[model samples]
Target: MTTMARDPKGYYAVLGLDPEADAEAIRAAYRQRVKVVHPDRDPSTRAREEFRRLMEAYAVLKDVIRRAEYDGVAPAEAGGESDFTPMPVACGTCGSLTAQPRYVVFRTVRSYLIWAKLGRLDGIFCRDCADHAAARASIVSWLWGWWSLPGLILTPFALLANLFGGSKPRRENTRILLRQARAFLGRGDLVLARSLAEQAATFARGPDDRARVAALLRATDGAVSGHHRRLKSRWRPGGRVFLAQALPLLALPVTIAIFVLIAIRPWDQPVSTVAPIAVHPATVGEIRHVAVDGLKLRMAPLPGAPVLTLLDRFTTVEVNAATASPDWVGVRTPAGIEGYVETRALYAGSGSRFKTEWCSDNRGAPPTAGEILSRRVSGDHRLLVHNDGRRDGVVKLKTLAGSTVLSVYVPATFHIGVGGIPDGTYRIEYATGTRYSRGCALFIDEMQASVLPMTVTFHYQSPTATRSLTNIAEVWLSPQSGTVPRPLPLPPDRFAADD
Candidate 1:
């Protein structure tokens, strides 16, 4: 290797070339120097000396053998080789001499509301390289750095800097360029970082260097581009962001209006009119049935006592046995109204009017009555009848309260009755058997007195026995007035006496 002497008048210095310049570089330098100091352009004596020196430098450097021999003798002749040695503080990429303790200012935009000075990078970069590094850093800062209101407001200035910033110097070594690119990346200048990384790959010296540079380029490209894509997606207008910002503002008025309306509306207005229910004071056992509507319940057991409430038909009451009177009964209405009502207005037990009938085994035959062995009136207008041992009997009872019909199955010589009857006339109907039978009779028993007791008898005849005993198959009864008695729709086997 031909090395130049570290002196002012050395041939390399005369041609403005480095000691490591190749033959081609020496020729090019000669040509450029001849243009600057050629006699045709400059007639000065100093120009002629400079021109001669440039020719001499090129002549020795252009020939390989001559340059080698000259280099060997020139360093010693110029006073030993140590003075000519290059400093370690040179740009690894451009190979340009640099001073130590150089500083670079790094600025980053942290967010839309923040701009941060990230301090300085300390290294040995030449002026041109330093400018390039700063430009690349700024580009990355603007591209990927956190954005703030201030940074966003000053985005135009940063863009201008990126577009017309210092140009990057040409580099020969991939490693140096990669180092700077990484520095720019650290500063958040992804665009400039990527550009430098790609340039580094192109300048790579070997396959290994090239592969490393290529990998770096790919990584930078993927990461930076992916990050940029994410940022763009996040800041995209409309959709969820718009709805999130808009819904609360729109709903505020609606919510307020709803509350105001609720607050102002009349809440005390009556929704319904309810007549007060009058409760009556009475004993637990004195249960009285309501026989008619408009039956006034008084506050005391007297006609002149103030009326507390009225009673409806079939409404039950608990009579105050201790307050019983001849003409009035102290009753507690279903509403718990403690008062008095006329004795005729309420009946004992259930106030249900029933239609009853007696039937025989022979269908469609007019029913006849046989002798009643024993008959008595029980509580609540109930009739208990013991029949002579002659036939199977059935008593069908239908209530006026509703379509509630009951069939009593009476075997031969059995006892049965009808109960829960209101104070009303009832027409009794019956069916005859195959033997001599008597016609049906109607009987009315009024339960005016509380302790009224009664018995009943009916006559019948048979040709063979001429006896009063006979089998009674069925019986029927209905109110004598107001509503006519309808035909009993009895089931064919409903009245069959269970053996």
Candidate 2:
């Protein structure tokens, strides 16, 4: 019933019929169109004219002789009432002939969030093949098309259109039908040729169409009948067809469930306690001193192995034997705990006697425990630094702009009070080691620097009208446990750059 904008003067167009429209389609279209444009019911000039054209179209198309004449096909060439044979072409799916062949393109759409794609299958097919193709395309679209923005809007419409016979060739050309009929006739396929000729007679409109279909049908009628093969449905397994139709619908939900289970495993793992390493008796090699504070004695050679205990600087450990990993050495601590420590953390001699090239320099005498090595400006605010560990360190105070405004040297078991600090926020950074490098102005060996997590503020205020108070910040250079904030490690190059 959809209004078609085909040729305005054409009889088929007047009734919204294509050249391929059969008797029933033509009648149905005429009935649907006539109700709206009936001249008697609606007294208008346009309605009267439309009604006249509709009647003319119906009169000619309804009668066999008159319709053939209007289409310019000979009534003799147009088969009789009992000789009905629709267009017969070699079915694309099967080699046998089909009376009704339609050119159809089934479309499918898929979406992946940001992108979308359109797919189609084009063929001149019979009813069964066309249905199969449309079913597959529609199923795939329904499963995947709703995932993206464009597909959500287009997929539903596409599926609906595909379900209803899909789309056919836009232009009607009976010449192609005539040519196919002639080819079949030449090949002595009388049954197929006659069927094609009959279909052509319905659509033939011009001198060329009329001449070709009449000659083909005449030859087919005169030719001797050949082997006739009736059209049958394409052979396909029922189970496979059902599976193919159903799998895509089930696949999406199954795949999503699998992905979700993989992403969030809700199962609990079995719990077990770690067993302690068995102690073995072995000859101890020369004693090695722990060169660094807070050195970890691990149960295995790996850096991430469980820590047996922490070794303080200058703590002595008995070297048992070399482990497979050269970086790690097997040793027994003073507490009889057997473990492995990094080779770099062990010195053959005492901490004071450990020597290196960078440690030998004496460019400037080392500062006293509480001496301020350098000061950019002076103020009443003060900072107290305590080094309770057995390692000497130099602490530097830098402003937010990265300027090193103050530096202090705090030795082992020594506390320092750095005064004359200006009233501003400052970051506390420090380096610790055994030997002080005067040349490098930093600890040379076993050197470690860190920036404290908390910044110190030196805000001065008048407690009363006449009494003034200066803020003081106190800190311990040793690492603290529990809820206390830990200092973040800093690269030696970055720490030395300020000095």
TM-score for candidate 1? 0.17
Clashes of 2: 0
Instruction: State TM-scores per candidate.
Output: 0.17, 0.28
Evaluate residue 32 in candidate 1 and report its C-alpha lDDT on the 0 to 100 scale. Answer: 81
| Per-model CA lDDT versus the true structure | 0.47, 0.69
Model 1 ranges with Cα > 4 A deviation = 1-221, 225-227, 231-296, 299-457, 460-465, 468-499
lDDT of 1 by residue, 1-499 (tens): 3334433348888887776676567888888889989999999999999888888777767754335334434344454544232212244235553321122233434443455333222223455554555555555655654366565545434433333332222232354556556555655666655766666665676787777677667767755645442211111223443444346445756987989878754442212112362234334467667655578887777778887877654566887545555556677776777877766555443243211112121124323343332222222344454434444443433222212133333444555654543333332322212322111111112111010111122223344754222432223232124533343443222222111
Number of clashing residue pairs in every model?
45, 0
Per-residue lDDT of 352 in model 1 = 30
Which digits, one per residue and each the tens of the lDDT, describe model 2 over residues 225-253? 55544333232324444455556545756
Model 1: lowest-lDDT 10 consecutive positions: 446-455
